[model samples]
Target: MGDLLGVAVLGAGHMGADHIRRLGHVVSGARVAAVADPDVERAKEAVAGLSGVSVHTDPSAALDAPGVAAVLVASPGPAHEEALLACFARGLPVLCEKPMVPDSAGALRVVEAEARLGRRLAQIGFMRRYDAGYRRLKALLDGGSLGRPLILHCTHRNVSSPGHFTSAMLINSSVSHEIDAARWLLGQELTAVRVLRPRSSSGAPEGLVDPQFVLFETERGALVDVEVFVNCGFGYQVRCEAVGEAGSARIGDEHTMVVTTGGRAAQEVAQDYLVRFADAYDREVQAWVDATRRGRVTGPGVWDGYAASVVAEAGVRSLETGHRVAVDLAPRPDAG
Candidate 1:
């Protein structure tokens, strides 16, 4: 086993707590050294069963904690900027959950700050990049096993979200995964994005538009189609299938991993987002830890985060304006 990298997780809510729970058991390359949450009791509870983990009421306290070289920002979306800036100030590599920020400007600020830092110091968590099925599919596509990808059919379904989540939030919260995956699958940036609002669903709140269609064209002449169904009345599901000139590569359902004879056959899909992406989350965390040990940034870079946010912002604009929105991709810096 590699030397354990001391890592701290910010926030102790759903996702933050989930990170703690996972690290508590079997993380080999890195271990949870500290935890922080606004609520002292909640922070304590978050690391309750973990051995030798210190909890702090203020997550910032961990910035100076001995041996803490990395931080994972699992706080709510609104707090992302603050948490990220703190980690950056400490020169700690951070793995932050996406939307990168609440909007485009916030994402740009991060990009600029990291550039000023003269190296990438943060990795936006878009865990699909680490998913085994997605990785395998990407390898197949990249190896030309599928030839030139012609079309990408994708789906983003959520069993449910917090009540505060909105129709526009669907694109940011859920469809952003499509933005990241489509770009990687095609190895291209989206040139245009358009959102089509179909009939709204009462399964969600009155104002929440549960189902929407998003169309984004990639620079490489490939078309990406995404169906965003936030209140799908089913478990969390993320799926993608790339159709190419030679053949098609698709992601099989995660629910296909079981065989049961107790009256019927059923392989249950994960009921929660964290559960579905658990392994990817683990890999992502370990990558961050490993990169921190080397004193560098690794995993999804600032460009990936910026590009995905640009597409997401354009998607929201498309929904608002009822027109196809053009994407202006930022120029990538030369890697020396």
Candidate 2:
């Protein structure tokens, strides 16, 4: 490794492009060494302002590019397993975006690959773990000030859905964050899942299940419920309230500046996740860079990613059958 960490970022789409910008501008001690996307022009465009950055259509070529010391996998979910396995083979530290593999079987393979290396090399992107509000809530819970948590109520709303959005994605893609968040917040494995569908919203695309309610039961007998509304046609919002034996704590309320006029008060609401969680993303990438420089892996690992996948798979099944589905996870490898 040189004075500055050199990173090869795969997939110059929305997430990848933002990360490229962050690596080049916002983050310290790192630079974008190379970028790869099937669309060469897009990759070039992402790194247009950066000097000494290589662009490639093939991800492996980018990984092999000169000065590349680490990899950041921002490719589509289906491509994550291959990219992660390749990183392991090269003994390169990686920071992979979430859904990890979008499926339990593939996610488990990622876990096994890292375990075989006998050391951690892949840090899965679950950036909420770095959010200021979430960290404070974690601290409060860990300190036992709230006593034993009895239930968690969560709400995840988006202004609208993308063209590729589907019913199952409501569980596997959108709600996946809540799955990981609830697990991390409670420090317990989710044992079962159930989904309930109401009337589709008028703003929802035709034949799409816009809003759904998901219920999760944890191993410690605690409950977590999520209200996911992708076509809310408003601003993005993510809120969580933890109910414990002694008291309760909540986070994610809009704290923006409010204007008062004509006896009306209004506050700004973030329209996108990127805007809402910008600081968290910055902290996450910087932490990854710092740890990788020290020859260590930190943050959410493949195990957390795999566990989220397993629980998400169960959530999807429950959505399809309208019946409660039990989550069954593969044994955890000792090394991860």
Which candidate leads the pack in lDDT? 2
lDDT of each: 0.82, 0.94
Where does the lowest 10-residue lDDT sum fall in candidate 1? 327-336
Q: What would the per-residue lDDT of candidate 1 be over residues 156-175, giving only the tens digit for each residue? A: 88887688888788887788
Q: Identify the runs in model 1 with alpha carbons over 4 angstroms from their true place.
A: 1-3, 256-263, 333-336
TM-score of candidate 1 to 2 decimals: 0.93
- Who wins the TM-score comparison? 2
Q: RMSD of candidate 1 to the true fold?
A: 2.2
1-336: candidate 2 lDDT, tens digit per residue: 269999999999999999999999998999999999999888888998899999998889999999999999999999999999988999999999998999899999999989999999999899999999998888888889899999999999999999999999999999999999999999999999999999999999999987999999999999999999999998999999999998999999949778889999999899999999999999999999999999988999999999999999999999899999999998889997
Query: Cα miss at 10, model 2 (Å)?
Result: 0.5
TM-score of 2: 0.98
